[model samples]
Structures are given as C-alpha cells and as structure tokens.
Target: MKRIPLLSTAFIFLWFSTTAQDTLTLSRGQCEAIFLRENLSLIAGQLNIPMAEAEVKQASLWPNPQFTLDEINLWATRHQTGGKEVSPPIIGNWGRNQQYAVSLEQLIYTAGKRKKLMALQGVGVEKAQQYFNDLLRNLKLELRRQITELQYLQLSEQTFQTQLQSVNDLLSAYERQLEKGNIAAMQVTRLQSKQFELQKELHELKQQNNETQKELKQLLHLPPQTFLKLSSEQFERALTDETIPTYQALVSKASTNRPDYQLALLEKSYFEKSYFYERALRTPDITVNGRYDRNGSTMLNFVGFGASIDLPLFNKNQGNIRKAELGIQQAKMLSQQVLHNVETEVAASYKSLLNAHAFQKGIDPKYLQRLDHSLDAHTRNFLSKNINMLEYLDFLESYQQNKLSILDAARDLNNAVEEVNYASGTELIP
Candidate 1:
C-alpha cells in the first residue's frame, strides 16, 4: 500500500526505465507541479484577490471635502477696483473690493454607513478568493484527465506501431513469394489489403491522440511540435480498495473543503451584510458648509455656516432594502441547494471509483503480454508454413483488441481517481 512518493529521484528512475532519449518522460507529480505554476487561467485568477481588496479599501475611505471659489470677477470696473490694482498678484493678499466669495462643505455619514460598507467589501473579498479556488479545482481536474489520457493513448500507439511493422514485413514476404511464383497474386493482394487497413486504423488513432496532445500542450505550457511523453507505468497494477472513507465522512470533508460550497455560504453572509448596509442608507447623509462674502452683502465682510439633509419622507432607500432582503433569502436557498448537490456528487463519484476498481481487479496483469508473445509466435509459424495465414490474422486481431481493452481499463481507473478528487474537493489519491 506504499506509493512512490512521486517527487523524489526514485520516481525519476521509474519514469525513465522505458523512456526514449529525446522524449520528455513525466510522472504524476511532475505534471501537477507544472499545472500549478504555469496554467494561464490560474495566473489570471490570482489578480482578482487584489482587486477585491482595493474595493474594501475604497469602501473604508471617507469622501474628500469640497472647496469652491465663488463668483470671482476677472476684470473689475474703476469703482470696484482696489487701490493700484495692475493684474492680481498670484501669491499676494486678496483685494477687499474685488467682489469675490469662497465656500467649503464636508459630507458626513449618519448611521455607521462607512463601517457597514467596509464589512460588505470584506465579504466581497472572501467571495472573490473562493471563486479563485474553485477555478483551480476545475482546471486541475482537466489537467489530471489530460495527462492520464495521453499516457493511455501513448501505450495504445506503441502497440499499433508494433503490429503495423509486423504486417509490413508479412506483406513484403508475400510480395517476394508472388514474384518467385511460390504464391499466387491473390495472396499478395490479401496481405496488401491487410497492410492498408492496419495503416488506416493507426492513422485514425493518431488523429485522436493529436487532439489530446494539443490540450496537453496547453496545459503544460509547451510550445508547438513538442511531443509529450507520459509515464503511467506506476499505475499499471490494480488499485488498492482499503482506506476509503465512509459516505458521511466524505460528505463532511466536502462541506469543509469544497470552494464552491464555501462560496455559497459566503454569498449568504454577503447578502446579510448588504441588507444591513442598505438599511443604514435610510438615515440620510449630512453636508455642512461655510460661506464668505466681500462687498456683496450688507455687512462688508461676512462669514456664516449652513447645513443640509435630504428628507427621509419620500425615499428612505425603501427599494434597496427590499432588494437586499430578497437577496438574503435567495442566497439561503441556493446554499441549501449546493449542499444537496455536494452530497449527490460525492456518492456518485465514489460509486464510479468502485466500478472502475472492480474492472481493474478482474483483469490479469499478464494477460496482454502473454497474448502478445503468443501472437508473435503464431506470426512466425505462419511465415514458416507451420500455420495458415488465416489463423495468424485472427490471433493478430484478437491481440490488438484485447491489449487495447486492458489499456482502457487502466485509464478508467486513473480517471476515476481524478473524479473522486474533484468531488471530495481534495486530492484523495495523493
């Protein structure tokens, strides 16, 4: 029940045991590391946290005070001009008869509105962070699927290539026999047809593999024409069934660890804070102003203070308060729905893992290798006239189909583990 520890030199040795000189051999640990460090979408998601924090900072700040220079005459007449005024000096004292006025006002929140806004923004920041975590969850799932799929396809591709070479050799021998009059043209034609069919199927497999490779390339941030080689050799055996947690334990872990679930709970809190903030808006803000006059009022130099407030009779933020209350109710309902979905997903994913595990256990690890060696013997016997070509072809087809099926079983097992990881909102396998 021991794993290879995934990151040490032992994994490197395991991966390179069958690796080619020019191909990149990667294990699960290597792929996971590359995905975390290089995924474009995840890098972009990191920016959201700082932006949400800026919103929190903006919410906590007070509005700047307003200042105004009111009704300053650019050119005064001879009667209103002060003594010897040649253009006004930029930094000198003001002229008494210039007929200028100034005013200042400051806005003040009435009912702890600033504090309420700060709290709401704090909730917004938490929501943004959870959203980022959810993004990581989704993209990491994609990464695991791509890596495992490429490994499976690579194994299949190797089998096909080997069979393809054998078919070519047989066709060449048939062509030589026809030329020497030992076999009829019909024999060579049949061998040629088989060769063509093998080629067509191999090409089709390559096309499917190319599509997966393109996706894998993006996930790994590799450049064009870079061939990816994956090492899934360590996962060839049947998965161990022991140590799986119970259904209740899995659901509880998902509730605690799932970002989407956390986001839903945060949404409810956000709405509750929004309701309070909206209600605080009903008290109306206060603006206090001071005014000054020169040569315009009955008193030669006058200064006075005034204040203003919007009457709460008509609008008291009634619509916003109702909207916030509705938001609170809506968030509560959605959170409950998310909780239900989490339980459902965990159970379904676990069942899928069990099915895949059963399939893997039913397969014999030596089945494909034994069949392949037997097919090679059959192929040699047919070449030596000890067996007919019909028997050889039948065994060849069986070998390909059986080997491909077992490869598919291995892939299903790995994919099932990824599904459980996604559902549990934690790396269960690791």
Candidate 2:
C-alpha cells in the first residue's frame, strides 16, 4: 500500500514530462516552408551555382605576363667589364658596376581560344544551375512524400487509440463481472486476450509513428525535443477531383519543367562547346617578349622585341579533339534515353494515381459513419448480455479491420498523388 503512492507519483511525473514537450502543430504547407528554409542539403546545393559562376569569371581572365631577370653580376670582375658604362646609374656607382638582363613576355592566344574556352565555361554555369534545380526537385518530392506518410501514420494511430480505449473499457467491465461471478473465467480471459492484442497493435503503430516523426524532424530541421503534430485541416480534401493531364501534355511539361531533362540538354551543349574549344587548341599561342640588357647583348643598353610560338610539327591536340567529338555523340544518346524514361514515368504514375483515386472513391463516407454507430451499439448490447461473446468479439474485429482498410486506402491515394507530382516534376495533382 505504501508503494502505491510512489508509483502514482512516478506515473504523474512521466505524464507531465511527456506532455510538457513543446508541441508544434503545423500544416503540410508550413512544414514545406520550414524545410525549404532550413534543410541543410538545399543550403549546400545553393553554393554550387556561385562556385560555377566563379569558374566562368576565372576562364574570362587573361594570363599574367612573365618577367625574367638574368645574368646579374652584383660585383664587377675585371673580365666582365668589357663594355663602357653606358647603362643608367642606380645609386651612382652601383649601376655602373652591375650587369643584368630583363625581359617581359605576354602569351597571346591564337584561333580565338580564349573566347572559346570562356564559352565552354559559360555552359558549365548553366549546367550548375540546372543541377541545383534538379536537387530541389528531388528533395521536394521526398519532403512531400514523408509528409503524406506521417499524415497516414497519425491517422492510423488515432484509430488504434480509439479502439484500444474501447477494449480497455470493456476489459474493466468484464473484470467487475468476474468478481461478481456474473461471467465465467474463460470469458474474462478472452476479453483479456483481446485487450492484449489491442495493446500490441497500438504499440506497433506508435513505434512506426515515432520513426516517421524522427525523419520529419530531421527533414524540417526541428529541435530533437520538439514534438510535432500535423494539423488535420483538409487532410482528405477532394484529391480525386483534380484532373490529370494527357500523356502528351505531361510529356511536354516534363520537357519544359523537369530539371534532370534540362540538365541532360545542357550536358549536350557543354560537349558541343567543348568540341569547338578543343579544335581551337590546335593553334599554338604566341609568346611576345620585350628585353633590355646591360653589357649582355651586341651593344650596351640593348633593347629588343621578339615573339615565339610552338611549331605544329608533332602534336596538334588530335587526341582531345577526338575525345570531345565522342562526348558529343554520347551526350546526345543519353539525352534521348532520359526523355524516354520521363515519358514512361509519367505514364506509370498517371495510371497508378487513377487506380488509387478509384479505390478511395469506392469507400463511401456514410458507410464509415454507419460502421462507427454500429460499433457503439454492439458494445452496449454485449455489456447488457443481449449479444453473446462470439458476436461481440466478431463485431469488434470487423470494426478494427474496416477502419484499417479505410486508412490504408487514404494512405495509398495520398502516396499515389505524390508519385504523380514526383514523376511530372510539377505539382500537377495539387
């Protein structure tokens, strides 16, 4: 008896701790908003665009000129003083004693290679932008899918909670009847078995719900201690009413809106530009130089200008040019393959959504209401002994199964809608 107070205190403390968590109730739209702003993957992906732009800037820059200073004699030896001291005086006698040569060389690109390379890098920037968009598209699909899944789990949990409560109440009444010897021990045992089944099912559902909750928290970047509760507002809105587009229309939209498809096209353009750039590389660049010498050339204080270039006698970048040509062909074929896959995805997602909507529509709302009403009536009749244990248990089992079926249909329909959106790369279903 003394331990009872301690147990009650512990239970109260646990309940308080659980309930004291900050419950954050948000709708799907709100969750998406938070995800877009806080998701780490998106923040990291956004950096790729700026990094690619920096590459384009670097490609546009000209090469730095090279300066050389050679043949410097700080102290003049008797043999080194062959010429007169015609060079300008640096600190008076110091310049007259020193002999050095200075030259500056500038590399001038031939065949417009600089501009061609810049154009290639410009294509890279576009590709980076498309890649970021593709990342966003894929992540949005995942976020929406998780949101739908959590909603389904929450709904299932509620149904199970309701059933568990009803079974517990019935179990308590049976225990009281057994005390009075109004029911057999076998009857009480059966009720206890049903109670255990309800508890087990409820525990499993809670475990699944907890896992979904953890995933959502990570996706939304919520604090670990924060509890999430999704708002049920319009959870079962008229999803079937949204009209799906024709196969051709969906294909057109995917070509226009899908980032992966656009990325493939950009890849092809990149390789095409690369081919031109590689062909330009065949021309050797000129290195123009201007030089000044002190007692080191044919005459003292000599000044000269000259240019040099590599002779195209052996290598002309043939290997790279061939590689670029092959890349162009490969990219073209890959883009075609991606288009075919896009069309197939749209067709498959469209068909699945149609079937899911039809299945959901077949379950009438009025019939579910009748099921609820009949469950309550059956429970009352069983307690009053108007219904036998077998009949009572049967109705209870039927109620649980039907509720699960309804929840399953709703979950499948929601997931199917998300599938259509993901495949089309647009919010067509919404």
Residue 292's lDDT within candidate 1 is 91
| Deviation of model 1 at 139, angstroms | 1.5
- Give candidate 2 regions above 4 Å deviation: 1-19, 82-91
Alpha-carbon shift of residue 211 in model 1 (angstroms): 1.3
Q: Root-mean-square deviation of each candidate, in angstroms?
A: 5.6, 8.1
lDDT of 2 by residue, 1-430 (tens): 0112212454345335545567777789878877777778877788888888898899888899999999997776666556655455677556776679999999999899888988999988888888888898888878877777778778877877777787788889989989999888999898888888888887887888788889888887777877778866545647645476676777788888888888899889988999999999889999999999887866878899999999989899999999999999999999999999998999998898888888888889888889889988988998888999899889889888898898778778777877777777777767
lDDT of 1 by residue, 85-142 (tens): 6444434665524667889999999899999999999998898889999999998899
For model 2, where is the 10-residue window of minimal lDDT?
Answer: 1-10
**C-alpha displacement of 277 in model 1, angstroms?**
0.2
Give the clashing pairs for model 1: none
**Model 2 whole-model lDDT (C-alpha atoms):** 0.82
Best by TM-score: 2
What TM-score number comes out for model 1?
0.86
**Each prediction's TM-score versus the true structure:** 0.86, 0.91
